[model samples]
Target: MTATTSPRVGDEIGPLEVRATTLEDLVRWAGAIDDYSPIHFDPAAARDRGLPGVVVNGPWKAALLSRLLTDWLGESGTVTGLRCEYRRPDVVGGTVRARGVVSAVTRDGAYECVACEVWIEDGAGERTVVGTATLRTRRPETGGAPPADGHGRAALIGDRLRDALRVGAEAGRFTYRVEAGDLARFVHAVGGRPPAETVGTHVPPEAPPTYYAVLDPVERRELQLEELLDELPFAKTGGGNAFNEVEYERPIRVGDVLTVVTTYEEPYERDGRAGRLLFRVRRNDVFDADGHLVARSRMGHVLAYDLDRVAGR
Candidate 1:
């Protein structure tokens, strides 16, 4: 059988414009997702909390990375996995760039490529988000391949678990404030109309469905991962990988304060024909200012150590 060939490692692929982060951007992001976190909008609450200012949400960063990969590979490639380490809090109103580099091309009669990405500091030359992604070419004719075994499945499942655990452990006690203008812009960008609750007008006092992006429970865990990666010492180790998979729970509205807390759930390991694999899981709990439970998030992650290199024989 002839092996499929793909792009070489270190291929540039293409350049992606990292959208600038702004107060308006954050608000729109929150509004689009229906989140009402004070930290995302309310400057006073942010100052009270001692952050430089309102911070961008974490999942948004993941989305940005996903956007980059999807754009580059077009619609034909399948995203096998993604992992992210939110290395720093990206303050609103700063320029950021998303960059990717092909790291490896492997074929066992099928072609696959691994790429690394980062949301780099546009002006300061720092990296705020680090990620790794795996993609398989969309060749439809290559049928009847062996099923991915315990090792492959563990890698996929473990990455999600780790993300859930990290979010659960660090997202609680974090706060965000959202402002009015922020809401307006986000609604506009996502093609959403202002709701009565959001515009403070003569409509029913209910939040628009889209506003939950700001206050959704998963948002808390999303933000927590950003904070954790920003502080992780291993973040600078430079060759580790990152990925993400996200799901939204419910809608959020304006004028709501969000409180997030995350917990590390569990870890598992498995052996495969290729090598050994490790997986981790996390859970996040979200709440409103009134202390009502809002949402929950679970995430997983997988780590693969290069056994040949580690053996040093």
Candidate 2:
């Protein structure tokens, strides 16, 4: 419970000190990450979509989950890998907390590796996001094989949709300069350290694992969760991020220029509690100015629709 405490397998990470979600927080995230999906900002759009009100951004929650571990392990700690699922919607104006428990701890030479299972819970005691993360203390520099060609159930895919899908296609590539101010905004939006512009708070030397996802998409047409789904006619409607998995080779540091290339994996289908859902995956490979890999992230999105409505048309 103390700052000097050593995390054991059962030790609980903070139900991180957090505050209620707000419209301003969503706007900050949108500006910082380029995930300017209207559902996060416009309550009217959310209402039109049948949602009760504006909902928290899924990527924002993912950042908070990483914050739960990084904050617990202290600044020296680095998140090596993270995988989370958006299980439920957390509406704006509601308070949600992130918590985790150390699942495993091992020493690999100079680094102490810790694995944790983390989740976000609403005031009603329901989990809105759930996942696991692997972290390490005392960073060691230097990190996927590609997804199989046919990753999902191809048989279930409609011939027209299947043929139209751009599996294994390169979406886009661009260079993005890393800035401490952006990192500061992301961290502050997710309830971490104060803004870098603050008189006393210094710019973070390295960004947390989720930083790659929140990087500005200044030149790219597609946003983080929608990268792989772009250009598909069926996907033109809209969808929500289902899950995100990322692995880091090294922490992204301020002043580093990154060349990021993203590609599409196979598209698939699945039946869900609501209805038949379409799933798409996007993989992003980040390289430092030296051309070394920085991180690799695969994002999954679930798109629900009515075949009958289209067929009737």
Candidates in order: C-alpha RMSD to true structure: 23.2, 22.5
Q: Each candidate: what lDDT?
A: 0.57, 0.73
lDDT value for model 2: 0.73
Each prediction's TM-score versus the true structure: 0.42, 0.44
lDDT of 2 by residue, 1-313 (tens): 2334445799888887456888988987888665667899898999999988999998899999887776666555689999999999999999889999889989878777888999999988799999999987764332122236863422233443434444576666778888877777667667643354454666577987778776424213444333333333342234578888888898889898998887767778876654567886778888988999988888776777554344223
Q: After superposition, how far is residue 37 of candidate 1 from its true place, in Å?
A: 2.1
Which residue pairs collide in model 2, if any? none
Writing each residue's lDDT as its tens digit, candidate 1 over 1-313 gives 1123345677764445555677777776875777767888887887788878877777777787777777666544667788888888777776666777888767645455555544544547677888788877654344243356653322223355466445335634555544555556556445555454446433323444545444434443344333322222221212222333334454455555667565665566575443455444555466777787766655555554444442322
Roughly what TM-score does model 2 have, to 2 decimal places? 0.44
**Which stretches of candidate 2 lie above 4 Å from their native place?**
1-5, 139-313
